[model samples]
Target: AQTVTQSQPEMSVQEAETVTLSCTYDTSESDYYLFWYKQPPSRQMILVIRQEAYKQQNATENRFSVNFQKAAKSFSLKISDSQLGDAAMYFCAYRPGGGGADGLTFGKGTHLIIQP
Candidate 1:
């Protein structure tokens, strides 16, 4: 079984600053994909970033990026130039690479607080 863990239950960042959310996972499968999904108060899960286990380079999207350490099973999300709109619950997710696997295995999630 695969599992995702977000150590920090809550995180806060000042506007225009950067904040990193910690995440770790346990998995026996060698091939898999990691993802960071953001859910605002509206409750829609948005894909922030994604990383493939086989990829050496980390994945990035705009001000969002991931520090994916495959060997240590660590995948963290970094939000740069944070904004008030970025406030939300962020979840770390996992999905096996092979076909026929079920949906994502998600972490408990981290609630982000943005301060003006």
Candidate 2:
């Protein structure tokens, strides 16, 4: 069974600052995928970042980036220059690397507090 865990239940950062959220996972498969999804107060699930198992390079999207350590089985998300709109519940999820086994397993979530 693959499991994703976000150790930080809540995190706060000042506006325009950067914050890194910790996440770890247990997976036996050599090939798999990880993703970070953000759900704001609106209750919409938005894809923040995604990292492929085979990719040695980390993934970055604007202010969002991921530190993917396949060897340590850890994946962390870094949000740089966070804004007030970035405040939300961030969830880290895992998906098996196979074509048919793409179902996602999600962590509880980390509530991000954006301090003005």
Model 1 TM-score relative to the real fold = 0.97
In candidate 2, what are the lDDT values of residues 1-116, reduced to their tens digit? 88889999999999999999999999999888899999998999999999999999999999899999999999999999989999999999999986675889999999999999
Clashing pairs in 2: none
Name the regions of candidate 1 deviating beyond 4 angstroms.
none
TM-score winner: 1
Per-model lDDT: 0.94, 0.94
Candidate 1 lDDT for residue 97: 88
By lDDT, the best candidate is 1
Clashing pairs in 1: none
